[model samples]
Target: MDLSMDPAYSITKSECVELCAGIRGEPYSVSVLKEGYCTAQSDGTFRADGTISLITGPRAVLVDTGGPWDRELLLSKLKEKDLTPAGVSVVVGTHGHSDHIGNLNLFPGATLIVGCDVSEGDRYLPNQLAEGQPYLIDDHVSVIPTPGHTGRDVSVLVKGTSAGTVLVAGDLFECCADEDSWRDLSENPELQEVGRQKALMDADVIIPGHGRLFRVHRTPLN
Candidate 1:
């Protein structure tokens, strides 16, 4: 679904961590698996949105495996959560960057879904998604393209409850970590701005690429 053509995904200039859309029910839980540190920036600022998300379900999906060095931590976090890599059937990336896609060697058996296409004969299995469209992996998951952090960058939106939405954002928002950090990280400022707006409008709970999990709540008007 092209969000641009779809009016339903309205753009809201939301204030992060201010609005509180509390978790209603845990039909599923999104565990933030802290991973590797992102490489330093051009301005000598060290940043890392290497955090990965583990969405627990009948068939689990591991979103963004951290850098190569983060393998131990990622695996330990999964073990703590009882999610063995063997059980991770789907491996989806928000974008193809070193820190984000570096840990792919861990899950050889899982289905690979990412920005670029890949194939190694029958040894490798891949699912390449269409650009500018939503990839409905299942009834509950949608991979929406938000080209800002990187042009091919995308974010994963997972349904938390019948009325609630969870956004697994990869490098989209670095949290309230710094105002300029997000702006600095954006490859295309205009497009990144647009994507951020849609995410704020549609997502109930946002799992930022580098920061902690946060919720978006609106104080109802009478």
Candidate 2:
């Protein structure tokens, strides 16, 4: 798939700083770290987004670690931020895709919170359904289940600084294309709609798996 077609394919202008994207929500700071990708399978190449490095004040986490092919470059990104692999407190993959989990093992000391394997931690989230929230982080950073891109896929939703709500979506949009590529890129297209609805509803700014950060513009569904 030629990802250049999407409006979000351009490189983000800002680095790690607070710039308002006009989302009506809480505050959080961010650094693009790497532009995400459109994962396509063919000839032993995993074309997908690079690691999405996010800073939510309380947590220094990476939603997806890009692909193993670019592991060193991803590490250098952390270096540029003065953060070593051990410094990152948490690493969460949106799903089990190689592009997202390529650098998981590098952060062995960090808590692994992804899919059903997410470790049990004492963190409370104040949100719509506050009773017995299972995820490790607080409502400040809520984890939403988004299966379909991969059956165990999940998206990390956190209130941002100026951008409002930010989601480190795994392969949620596979680089933020039209709904056509959205469904076409999924492992199970039939099951993706449910996840899609949840993503659109929960996030205002999506740090898509393989694309630049894009504001979530909601519209009525057919």
RMSD of each: 5.1, 7.5
Q: What's model 1's lDDT at 79?
A: 93
Worst 10 residues of 2 by lDDT: 11-20
Worst 10 residues of 1 by lDDT: 16-25
Which candidate tops lDDT? 1
TM-score against truth, every candidate: 0.77, 0.73
Decoy 1 TM-score against native: 0.77
Query: Candidate 2 lDDT, tens digit per residue, 117-213?
Result: 5642444224322232335466577667677776767777777456667777767666555447677667787666765655565556676666656
Model 1 lDDT per residue over 85-104, tens place: 88888787888987788888
lDDT of 1 at 222: 38
Instruction: Tell how far residue 185 is off in model 2, in angstroms.
Output: 2.9
Note the residue pairs that clash in candidate 2.
Answer: 27-160, 27-161, 28-160, 28-161, 36-49, 36-210, 36-211, 37-49, 37-210, 125-139
**What would the TM-score be for candidate 2 when compared with the true structure?**
0.73
